[model samples]
Target: MNLQRFEQLIAAYGSQAHHWPVAERQAALSWLQQQPDNALYCQAQQLDMLLNQSVAPLPAPQLYANILAKICPTPFRDGYFYLCHWLWGESQWQHCWRPALLLGLPLLLGLFASGLSTPSVEDLLWLDLEQSWVLMMAGHEMDL
Candidate 1:
């Protein structure tokens, strides 16, 4: 890997071989062994033990409680689940895409079609001026 990527991997994964990607772990270990004096690697390894010892995040207790509901069997969510999400809020990421596609695609298509059908905004304004001029001529002819 390049110096930047190596430094990134060192910073993100630490000096531990197991923490590194499985495919690259051996290569990184070898590189570290070959270059123990490398200043970049030394800096990255500073928190290697401390950060690893720190607790990794655990999922919410509510998620595990959902498995219990599977045995109890709750009714499936309906379309109103999304419609009411703005007020109650939603946690799951999978809910965002469907609504975006449903609403955004139609809006995008309408704008695209409007642009395609236009004589253009400038042409519409000029047409309005032409109609006004015709009305003024009609008024002048009526007076004559």
Candidate 2:
């Protein structure tokens, strides 16, 4: 893979490098092994050290309360801010409708516009399949 994509994969694995897919982990490891003096090798070493450091554990009860507070705020049962955050946090749903519209709108507009512009094959009977093919094949006909 390209260096940029390799770097992205490393970043995604983050502090949980061990959690990276086995095949990808091996590939990264192999690439690094092959290039001990590579600039990326130094970066990878720093990243590995960063991943090895331990994070301070939070109290389960406090963590749960914090998560709930963020998801379901205190102002109301259905708080505007909470709902907005929820929608924004999971933006895949927003993109679902967007892609449909992006694809469907162009298709629909093309169909509508075609109706207003061109006649169907049946309507243009003078230019039958045989006649059209002959004209195309004839090129610039003989001078005679």
Candidate 3:
């Protein structure tokens, strides 16, 4: 690799050769060997040593409680939230059919009930014939 690229690798992955990506590790090593007195490499090594010695700060004692409070506000509402979470967290194909079945079952039942309640074409034709027979008898009685 070129000097500029070697400097970039050192900046991104730290001064340690092991930290560098496997593909570019050999190229960076060869470049470093050619320039044994690289100022950037020395500076990066110093920075890495300082960072390695530093300790991370601990979180607050109430952090877990605060996160839980934000995620689930009320104990009673937690059940509904959990149920929805479980339903949606499944695989995409499985989750898609659940809501469809829930809504479609009620819609199908309503359609079936309506079909049962409505009169058929044969029933309407028979009712019309009975009405006509009654009207014809009434006309004959009026003539008499």
Candidate 2 on 56-100: residue-level lDDT in tens?
Answer: 976888888889888865787568776655545557876576666
TM-score, candidate 2, is 0.29
Residue-by-residue lDDT tens digits, candidate 1, 1-144? 656766778878777677889888776777777777878777766777577678879999998888887665544553555456653446555467656666789999999999988797999999999999999999999999
Model 2 residue 33 distance off true place after TM-score fit, in angstroms: 1.7
Q: List where candidate 1 sits over 4 angstroms from the true fold.
A: 1-5, 56-144
Clashing pairs in 3: none
Query: lDDT values of the candidates?
Result: 0.75, 0.68, 0.88
The prediction achieving the highest TM-score against the true structure is: 3
- Candidate 3, after superposition: displacement of residue 65 in Å? 1.2
Specify the poorest-scoring 10-residue window by lDDT in model 1. Answer: 74-83
lDDT of 3 by residue, 1-144 (tens): 898899899888889999999999998998988897898899899999988899989999799888988886787677878877766658898688877776689999999999989988999999999999999999999999
Name model 2 segments beyond 4 Å from true.
2-4, 14-19, 58-144
Q: In model 1, what lDDT does residue 105 have?
A: 92
Cα displacement (angstroms), candidate 3, residue 60, comes to 2.6
Note the residue pairs that clash in candidate 1: none
